[model samples]
Target: MTILNETATRTDRWTPVCSYTDLLPERGAAVLVGTMQVAVFRTFDGALYALGNFDPFSGAYVLSRGIVGTRGGEPTVASPMHKQVFSLVTGVCVDDPAVAVPTYPIRVTDGTVEVSVV
Candidate 1:
């Protein structure tokens, strides 16, 4: 698993997992991230977001289906397995600020969505 709050190691070509158009608002899908699973999403406004797919509390692969919304202008997704909301930008759980998920560097190039898994 990728460690958070530590020195970040850079990698070449963050494997293309999914596309921006693939996500459905209020829904989510899982993709592979260098052996790790990542969830990429598209908001109602067509904005792209990425986050780890597993839920820390339940340890279930269910963060993708979490509701996508904003809290104080920060994009966030609420876990479907539970109600733990996570900021799409920071991946920090809204309900509990201490816990967070591994967020990847996401960018759109030529209509493709890519993430930095390392």
Candidate 2:
């Protein structure tokens, strides 16, 4: 008999990255998932977010090292190279709407943080 639930099956697509408490509030961490570099962030409100670690402005994988903050009530991270702010939720550049980065799906499971590239 199968005791697994639907949620458990869904979690198969999620890749565990780190513990929920490992992430400092308003800071970002970089993780590699299947050849993809992902930047994970945790807001002061205990919210988790993930975005591509590549910074379009500087053509560098330093988004994870950017400064975390907010803009217009939206969680944001500014590129450390050029200081371009990007929305953590949508991965859109707040300074330039025409340009945007990629966002990934992130979640917390049993105190562990997970990011899905697929």
Candidate number achieving the greatest TM-score relative to the actual structure: 2
Local accuracy of candidate 1 as per-residue lDDT tens digits, 1-118: 2222222444355566665566667566788877888888777666666788999988998898788888999888889887889998788998999999988776665556667776
**TM-score for each of the candidates:** 0.82, 0.89
Instruction: Give the number of the best model, judged by lDDT.
Output: 2
Instruction: Return the TM-score for candidate 2, rounded to 2 decimals.
Output: 0.89
For residues 1-118, write the lDDT of model 2, one tens digit per residue. Answer: 1111113223457787898889999899999988999999988888888899999989999999999988999999999999999999888999999999988777776787877777
Query: What's model 1's lDDT at 43?
Result: 71
